[model samples]
Target: MKRILILFVLAGSMLSACNKFLETKPEDFVTPDNYYNTEADLDRALNGVYNRLVDNFGRMYSRGLFSFLSISDEFFYKNITITNLKVMDFDAGQLDVGKLWEVAYQGIDRANILLENVDKPKMDETRRKAIKGEALFLRAYFYFVLVDNFGGVPLKLKSTNNPLEKYLPRASVADVYASIVNDMKGADTLVSDISSYNYNERVTKTAVEAVLARVYLTMAGEPLKDVARYNDALIYADKVINSGKHNLNPDYSRIFINHSENKYDLQECIWEIGMYGNQLGNTQLAGAVGIENGVECTDDKIGYSTGPLKITARMFNLYAATDLRRDWAIAPYKYVTNTTTGVTTKTPYTAVQIYDRTVGKWRREYETVTPKNRNYNSTNFPVIRYSDVLLMKAEAETQVSGAPTAAAYDAVNKVRRRGYGKPINTPDATVDAPAGLDKADFLTYLQDERARELAFEGLRKHDLIRWGLYLSKMQSLAVDISTNAPSGFRYGANAAKNITARNLVFPIPNTEITVNHLVTQNPNW
Candidate 1:
C-alpha cells in the first residue's frame, strides 16, 4: 500500500504522494524565488513540509520524544552502556538533544516556507486554501511539539534561507501556546473534513480540533495552570466527538496492526505520520518504530528487534485478567529462534516475567512489507487517535465541573468496555469505574486508564508532566524498581533514579545556545 505512494523529499525540493491516481516528477535547480509557479509545484512543496515529520531515524516521536529523551514511569529505555538520553542523564550538548531540536525546527521552518510560497502558485482556489490550512496546522503542530518538550522555544514565524539570520531569543511559553492555539483554530476553519478523503495522512479539520483539544488540556495542567482552558479543550473535543466520523477501533491490537501493515483505520487513528518503504527504496522514507519498540526477536525473518526500550510490571498490573488488551499489549512470552532451523519460537512466561517484557504494542511480526529492514519499518506512527480525544474530553469535562460527571464516565467507560473485549455500547459495572469518585480519585482513574488504553503510543511522559506527577512518579518508580525488580533487571531503575526537576523540560540544544547569544540554557543543564 505504501509503495503506491512514492514520496521523495530532497531537502526542500522534490516529493510526491499518490491520491491513488497521479505522480509528480522530481524537480531541481528551481530556487525559492521562482519555484512556486504551478499547482504541482505547490503540491511538491507541501509534501516537503510533510516530509519533515519523519517521526523516526532518531528524529522525533518514536526515536526522540517517545523513546530516548522523554522519561516514563511505565517503561525505561534500558541500556547500561549508553544511559545519556534514555535515563534523563544527558545535558544540553548531547547530540540527540540537538537532533531533536533540529528536527522540530526543520518541520516548522519547512511549514513556514511552504506558507510563504503557497500563494505564489497559480492553482485552484479551493485546493490552495486547503494546502494553506495544512501548512498552518503542521507549523502549529511542530511548535506544539517544541513547546511540550522544551517549554518556550525561539519562536520563528518567517521562513529564512539565510544562514546568518539573526538568532532570536526564546518566546514566553504562554505566547508560544497562544500562537499554537490561534493557528490551529484558523486551520480548523480552512482545512478539509476527514470525511472528504479516501486516504488517512492529510491534515483534516478534526485533526486540528483534536490537537487543539490537546493544547488546551496541556494549558490547563501543570506549569501553565490556566484552568479556563479546560472549557476550551472540552469544546474542541466535543467538536470531534460530535463529528460522528471517528470512534475506537473495536480491536485494539488491530489498530496497531493497521499501522504495521500500512492500512488506515481512519475511524480510530485520527492522524498519523504516514511513512512508506523500508528505507531500501529509492525514496528512503521509513520509520524505526516497531524495530525500536517491538517484542525482541533474534531472527530477521521473524522481525528483528533490538528492544532496549522495555515495559514493566507497572504497566502489566494496570489491567485486569479479563482485559484482553493486557496480554496483547505486553508480550507475555519469551522469543527464541533456533539457529539451525532459523525458526522463531515463543515460550509462555511465568507470571513474574512480565516485569522484563519488551514493548509489545508495536510487534513487527505483523508488518506485511517484504524484505523488511532490521532497523527501519514503514510503520505509520499515530499522532492522535479518537480514543485519545475521548480521554481528553473526559478529563476536560471533569476538570471544568470539579468532579467526575456522568458524561465523563461514559466517555472513558466506552474505551474501558472495548479494552475488556465487550461491546462498547454495553455497560458492565464490573469493568467500569464507579460513577461517584471525587476529582482526585477520578484523575487517578484517568492516569491508570490512559496507560492501559494508550501505552507506548508516545504519550505517557507528557501525560505525567501535565498531571504534575512527573518528578514524584519517577522518584517513586526508582524506589519501587530498586526494591522489587529481579536481580538482572534492577539496573533499569537507574533511569528513574537519575530524574530531577530539571528533567521535566529538555534542555535547549547547545548548538542553539552558542549560536544565539541572546538565548539562555535551561535550568541545571
Candidate 2:
C-alpha cells in the first residue's frame, strides 16, 4: 500500500458523518475524511505552511534571491547568475526558475486547499479566521514575490483538484497586484493585532501592513510609477509606526545575535523569521563570520559562501568611526592559540563583510570544532523592521511633495539617532542630515541610509533597483567582483565603466524560458 501524506486527511474525513465528533476522528493518513476535521487539524495544517519557510533558502534563494541580490552591486561575480554578476552570465532560459515558480504555487495551493476545506463545523471562530488570514497572507506574499520578479505569473487563486491546470498561462501584472492587495487587506482584518508573535514566528496584522506599504512603494517606483501610490505607502507605514507596539533594541550589535534571538527591540522590526538551532552539543555559526573567517567547522566559508554579498569599500567609508554598527561590520583578524602545540595561528583572513569597505553586521560566537574550525551560533533574519517603515514613510513624504518633509526627517532621524547610541534625537548631529536635501538628493540619502541601517538584511537590491541606480552601482561592483589583484584577474578604476543598464533586470533564467512558454524574456536576455 502506498503511504499517503497527512494533508490528505481532509479528503477522507469528508465521507463520514458531518457530526462534530467525526471531525476529530482520524482515518487512514492520506485522506482528509479521516483527519483535518477539527480545529487542531487546521492548526497543524497552518504549521505546515510555516514550515515551508525553511525551504525558501533552497527555492527562493535561487531565483528571487538572485534577482534581489543582483542589485548589480551585490556580489558582483561574473559567473553568478541572476542580476548583474560579471563572474557569471545567466541565461533567461535557465530552468532554475521552474523550481521557484513551482514552490510558490505549491504553497499557494496548500493555502487554497486549507481555505476551501477548513471551514468545517465546530471550528473556533478566532482560530479559524487566524488560520485563514495566515494562509491568505502567505499566498499573497508568495504571489507578490513571484509577480514582482517574473512580471506576471499564473494566478492560481483556488485549489485545483485537477493537475492539468498547473500549466495555466501568465496573468497580467495588474491582475496579480490586485489579488495581492485584496488578499492582504482581508488578511489584515483577520490577523491578530500583535507586533511580535512568540518571537516573531507568526505573521500579524502589522506584517500585512508592512507588505502593503512595500507593495504601494514598489508600485510607485517601477512599471507603475504612480506618484499617487506614495501617499498610500506613507499611510500604511505611519499606521505601523504609530501602533506603538515596537521600539529599537538598545544594543544594535546584539539585535542579530543568537542570544538575543526573538527579543523584540525597537518598534522597528515588524516581521522576522524566528529561528532556534539545535543545542545538542554541536554548534552552528552565523553565515557572515563563519563563511568568511574559515573559523566555522560547518564547511561554510565566508570567502566562499559570502563572495557575492561582501561589503563594498565605499560603504565602509560612510560610517562614523564611533558607530557600533561599524564594529559589528568588521571583525579584526583573530588568532586562536592551540593549547596543545602552544602555537598561536592567526586566522589572517580579511574578506569583505557587507561591502568590502564595511565589516559584517551579522556575527555569532564561534566554537572551535577543530584547530581551525568553529562550531555553533544562532542568529535570526529580520524580514520587516520598523526602521524600514519609517524610511518608507520618509521616501513617500518626499515623493508626495518635492523635498524631505520634517516628518520624513524625524522618521529618518529616529533610525539614525538609535544607531548613534544616544537618546533618540531629531535634528541632532547624527540625525541632522543636510536639511536642504531636495527630493532627488533626499532619495539618494535614503538609499545610502538604507544601506547603512539595513545592509546585509537583503533589502539592498530592491532599494537600488527602485532608485534606477542599479547599473551605475553594478559597474562599481563589477570591478570589485572581478578577480582582484591578489587573485590575478584585474580591472582598473576605469574598467568598471564597461557595465551597462542592460544588465539591470536579470535575464529570465535561460531554463525558465526554455520550459515556460508564457514568460516574455526581459530586455537583453
Candidate 3:
C-alpha cells in the first residue's frame, strides 16, 4: 500500500472504507483501485494538490519560503532567526529549508498520483485532459522551485509506493529544466483558456505559457547561460501579450485591494494562490508584510502587529517620488499616540526611523468580508500577473537584441505608465519613456523596474541569483546600511562577509542528505 497521505473529502464525507472476506481476502484499505474510479474522485484528488498551498505548516507560498527569500537586499527582519537568513548565515539545518523541501516533494507526489490515475476516471475527455494538465503544471512548478533554490533536486516523477524507492538521486539542472519545459508545453495544449476558467486560482493555458517564459528566462541567465533561449522567452511572453486574454490592471492599488476582497481580475492576474476565509483557509501573508498599528499611519486599518518582514530604506529609495508605487509600496511615516496629552501626531520617517517599515500593499483594511484579525487574512498571493509577462518580454527582448527594441520599450513603458497613473501609450519622454540608453543601461533599468513592480512577492532573491548578483548585492547593501542607515537596521554585522558564491544556491536540508544517501549538499554550507 502507498504510504502517501491522500486526503479526499467529497460531499461532506471522508472517503474511507474497509473490506472483509472469509476466503481469498483482499486489502481492507482505500487504494487507487477503489478510490480513483470516478470524476468526483479525480476532482477531489486534484483539490488535494491545491490544498498544499493552504497547508500552514508546509505551503511553499507561506511565511517559510517568503521569509527565507527575504534575506535578500529588499527586506529587513528584526528577529534573530530571520536576520541570519537575511545575512546568508543559514545552513541546511534551517527549519524553513527542510519544511519547504518536504512540502514541495509532497505536492509533487500528489500531482504524480493524480496524473498516473487520470485515465481511470470515465469523465468527459476534455475535463480529464484539463485535470491532467493542471497536475503536470503543478509538478513542474514544484520541481522548478526545488531546482532553482537547491540546484538539482531529486526529481520524483512518480508516486513512491515503497520506502526504498524514495532514495532517488538529484537530476542535473539541465534535465530538470527540460522536464519543466516539456510539462509546461504539454500543459499549454491541454489546459483551458483563462477566460473559460472559473477563477485565476486554477491553472490555465496562459499561466503555463507565462511560467514557460519565466523558465526560459532563467535558462538564459546564470548557471545555465542558455542565451539562445531568449528567443523562446520572447515568443511565449509575446503570446501572453497578444492573446488579449489578460491586461495590466489600470489601478495598481486596486490589484491588491481586489485580491483582498476575493474579487480577482482574470484580465490582469494569470494565477494566484487562493487565500479565502478568516480562519481555516487564511494565511499570514498580510501580517508578515503589514505594518503594526499605533504608528504614524494609525488611520490605516491594517491592524496587524507581527510585521516580520519590514521594508528597508534602500528599497524605499528605489522608487521615484512621482511613482505612485512608492507611496503604495512603502509607508512614508507612522503615527505615535501621546498617552499624557491624549493626542495623536504623525512622525515622518525622516524625523524618527520606524523600526518596522511596513509594506503598504495587501492592507487588511481592504478586506471587506473577513473579520479584522492579524492571524486571519484572506489576501491572495500573486503567482503570475500580466505586468510580469510584459517585464519578462522587455528583459528577454533586450537580452536577445543587445539593446532595447521598440517592442521592449513599449512593453516596459506600459507597466511604467500604469505606475505613473498615465495612459498606457503615453509618449512623454520625461514621465513615461526615458530615451537615449544603451543595452547595458537598459538592462539595469529593467532590473530596477522588476524590483519596483514586484517587490515582496517572494521573487527578489531568485531574481538576484539568476542575474548573478546575489552575493555582490548583499555585500553592497550591507556596506550601505552600515555606513548610512539608521541604528535600528539589523544584519549589517554579518552581511558583507557571510555571503559567498555558494550562498547563491541554498544548502539542501541536512535531514534530506541523512535520509537519502544519494542526496548531496550544494557546495559550501
Candidate 4:
C-alpha cells in the first residue's frame, strides 16, 4: 500500500476519504471547515499540488508540449512519429494540447480549493500563510503557462459549482497576466523566506522572485517587448542572484547527481521543483523507458533509463574543448556483468546522458539488465538552476540597453567561467556588452551558452522558439547525427524524418475544444 503523506494531496487526489474531518459543507460532498486543521494538512495539500506533475498528462502540459512541440524538429524516436513534431494530424485531434489544457486547469482548481479553505480556525496562522502563498504561486504558474500558450483562457479564480460560470468566454490575456502578477506578488510577500524550508517540494521566497522575473521577462519579450519590462526582469533576477541564499554548485557534474537534493549553486537558482527518490521524487519514465543512441535492447522497454533520448552530434560539437561542461555531457562506460553460466557479459553503453544535456542525469542501476528495460540508479532532477537566471538577465539587459553591458558580460562570464572551472570575477572587472545583445555576435553567444548550460531541463524547446532558430537547428542536427551514426544506421531514421513547421504550436487538444469553446487552436496546426 502507498504510504499516505501530505505530498499525495498535491498530486491531485480527491479527499473523499476524509469527509469525517470537515466542519461545514462547502457543498454536499465537500467542506473546508473540516479540513485545514493542522500543519501536516497544509503540507499534504502543498504536496498534492506538486504531485499533479507525475504522469505524462501532468508533465506534458508543463513541459513536453512546449519542449517537444515548440523547440526541436527531431521526431519518431524508434518507430513512433509524434504528431507535433511532424506538424500533421493536429487540430483538436492532438493529445498533447488536451493534456496540457486539462492538467493546467486541474492545477488551478487544486490551488483554488486550498486557498478557499486552508485558513480554518484550527490551522496555524504561519503554516496557513505559507500554504496560501504556495497555492497562489502555483495558480499563477498555471495561468502563466496557459496565457503564454493559449493567449486568453477563461479565468477561473474561484472554485464554483455554477455550471454557467464554467463556460465564460476567454478572458483577455491582459486580465490573465494581471491575475498572475497579483498572485506572484502576494506570494513574494507572504513567504518572505524559504531558505529554512529547504525542501524542494515547497516554494520559497526565491521561487516567487524567480517566477516574477520570468513573468516580467516574458512581458518584456512578447506583445509589449517594452524596454522598461526588460529592466524589471533584470532587477528581479539580480535580487535572486545576489540574495546570498543560493549560489552555483562548484562541481557542474554534481548539479544533477543522485545526492543533489535541495542543493543550490551560488550563481542564481531562484526557484526549482524539489524532488526526492522513492514515491516523492522518483521518475520511472525519466529513468528506464526508452532507447537512445543505437544501443539496442530486444525488450519492448522504451529505455528511459538509458535510451529514447540521445545527445545529438550538433550539441556535442557545440561544446568548446576547454569547457568542463563537455565532461558533464557524456561519459563512456562499459556495462559488464558475470552470469550464472560462468561467463562475463559486457555491453558498451557509450553516449551522452540526459539531465539537461547528459543523456540521463539520473543514471543508476538496481541490477544489470538489457537496454530495453533497465532500472535507474540515481534519484533527482533539477528543474531550475542559477545559470538560467543569468542567461535570462543577459537577454533582458541586452534588450533594455540595446547592447550587451559590462553587467551582462559579467553575468554570462560568471556562468562561462564556472563551466570552464575558473574563478568567478566580480562585476567591476567584467567587460561591457549591449542591450538585448542585439549585435549578432553577442546575442549568438548568449543563445549558444544557454543551450550548453541548460540543455535538458525542459528549456530547449521553448528557447528555440524565442530564438526563432528551431527549424534550422533541428534540420542541421538531423543531418549531422545521421552522418555520425554507424554507416547505414537503421535505428535513428525516424528521428530524421519527424521535422516540420506545424510543430511550432501544438494543436489544442480535441477533448478541450469540444468541452470548452473558449480554448482556441493554435495557428497552422
Give the alpha-carbon lDDT of every model. Answer: 0.81, 0.58, 0.72, 0.56
TM-score of 4: 0.77
Candidate 4: misplaced stretches above 4 Å? Answer: 1-30, 37-39, 56-91, 162-165, 222-227, 258-270, 276-306, 331-358, 365-378, 426-438, 475-501
Per-residue error at 371 for model 2, in Å?
16
List model 4 lDDT by residue over 1-525, tens digit each. Answer: 011122132222342111111222212232455565667666555655554543333243223542344334322243334444422334666566667777778778878878877766475577677778888988998888777766667899887544566576778767898899899989887774756653443567877887688788777554444447778888888888778777676667666542223243323444544322222232221221112222232323322332334455566666776677765544333243344554433354444332123243433332123332333211224455777787788878787778878778878888877777767564322222233445567878888888788765556766675456666776676676566555433244344445466554556666767887866666665
Which ten residues in a row are the worst by lDDT in model 1? Answer: 15-24
- Give the residue spans of candidate 3 off by over 4 A: 1-29, 79-83, 280-302, 335-356, 490-497
Per-residue lDDT over 139-215 for candidate 3, one digit per residue giving the tens place of the 0 to 100 score: 99988988888889887788877665648888999999999999989888998888776578788999999999999
Give the C-alpha lDDT of model 4.
0.56
Q: TM-score winner between 3 and 4, please give it.
A: 3
4, model 2: CA deviation in Å? 23
TM-score for each predicted model, relative to the true structure: 0.95, 0.79, 0.88, 0.77
The best candidate by TM-score is 1
